[model samples]
Target: MRTIDRRPLALAGCLFLAALCLAPQTAHAHLVQTGFGTFYDGVAHLFITPPDLLVAIGLGLLAGLCGAAASRSVVFALPAAWLAGEMAGAFFPSSLALPWLTTVSFGAVGVLVALNANLPRALLVALACGAGLLHGFVNGSTMVAAGTDRLGMIGASVSVFLVITLASGLVVSLRAHWAQVAVRVAGSWIAAIGLLMLGWLVRGQG
Candidate 1:
């Protein structure tokens, strides 16, 4: 483990704390919360207009940055990967069973990323696939709930996020100076955010 300055780490820690404290109030960006994902009506509008797309892009970048801060460079791919995995799962029949799968899939991919964050971008694409599956499952179910077209909306959202994530990934990849260290620093932050998300998700269920 390359030991760097504690000052930066400490600074990052404070920011993480702030984000965690404020996250509860600010998580909803355009996407309305119909309570838990399981409780959502199927036809929720994703706000695909320019403003919404811009929001998605911004959030997608934020998610990537957060992931990179949390786990390392591996974290960089997480948001896109998770989004892809979750969304792909929507193509199939989604139910209460899907959330457990989403959790497990994310946990598994996270472990892999933690272990080999520097692996080629190609593998990162695979991670995105798994993420899309989970995303799709929940989305499809939501569409189903509201009697909306599942495949069409899922495709649109996936395209939007994919482009956003890919652009974010490129930005990270291009800044190759001390990239490993960068990944580690970013991964920790992303993990912090993920933990908060997990907590909120758990609370919603309870």
Candidate 2:
């Protein structure tokens, strides 16, 4: 019997291409904060710079996408990203993150990874949380370092997480039926995006 193939991977290339078509626009708006909060910080493959709050919330949503892809549980990923971002922020100016936020963020990720994860969920959340943390933390660090005033710094941090969650969540929420293929495709796409951002970060440093 022919089974219903739930994978959008068959069209991964097409989707990727389509995504690329829109990438130029997304590139205009990136997670990495750039010089003094006023730059694109572009790269051919990667992108980074200090982000506005909209970007942070979008990232949180992206985490949800990863979680959904990994375990079909979008619910877990959003919070995971939020906790991780906040936790990482608490770490600013030091190796050690704020004790409470750090512990809680890591703990939340761990708990969800242990409990919410299943066959697919385990891998998905793991991947999502890992990437999410890196992006979130760096963004947090940037804000802490860049802003001139304490209020400005706090504002930046909030912008980072708030935007990521908002954007990612908005994107994921639209794809309601929970199609495995769609979710997996989203996970793959977002992961690729992360790699691109990382590349941008490296290039900026270089």
Candidate 3:
């Protein structure tokens, strides 16, 4: 008799729960003037935005699938790359093409997760860095007009780092086959969303 793997199924459920529980919609285009302001605002922005949160979580899950070395790479690369992008966005002019870059990141990561791929460590690190940059660039551009660039960048980077770490840690802790399947399913969902977003972008352009 052969043993069945339920870990993948369980992992899928876990991913969905994380996405639903932690994600919501926020006005990413403008800074929230009320509440704590600045630094806290950046943190709040990430928690409240579904798209941003989804992609970040996806990246974490993908890293976890690759094992500890990959997970560690993401932890090191993502935040640092994001902070660098934020700095560039603050100091330099913004690009209209930048927002779409995140969609590309989301789509690419989602595909990798759905496939359960075993990519090289170097490639994974590079991908993580790229996603981080796109996410950070958007964050910085949004707050740049308000003069809270420094605090907001710090807050956003910290919040994102913690979120990715937690998600990846949770995924990596699971060793069952069903959990792995579930993660793949979750990845499919992310990819679908990214595809829809990409379509919308094309329509707007045309």
Global lDDT scores for all candidate models: 0.44, 0.41, 0.78
Q: Which predicted model would earn the best TM-score?
A: 3
Give each model a TM-score: 0.43, 0.35, 0.80
Each model's total of backbone clashes? 46, 37, 15
Would you give me the overall lDDT of model 1?
Answer: 0.44
- lDDT per residue as tens, model 3, 1-206: 99999999999998885554333233246666547878898888787766668778888999899888889988878888888888887887363334455676788789999999887888988988888887777777766865675988888888889988997898899889999899999999999888888677656541
Compute the lDDT for candidate 3. 0.78
Judged by whole-model lDDT over C-alpha atoms, candidate 2 comes out at 0.41
- Order the candidates by lDDT, highest first: 3, 1, 2
The most accurate candidate by lDDT is 3
- Model 2 Cα lDDT, one tens digit per residue, 86-158: 3565465333222222222333333332232243555555545654565445444544454333333344434
Give a tens-digit lDDT track for model 1, residues 49-133. 2222333333333334344432233333434443454345445544443333344344444344334344444555455544554
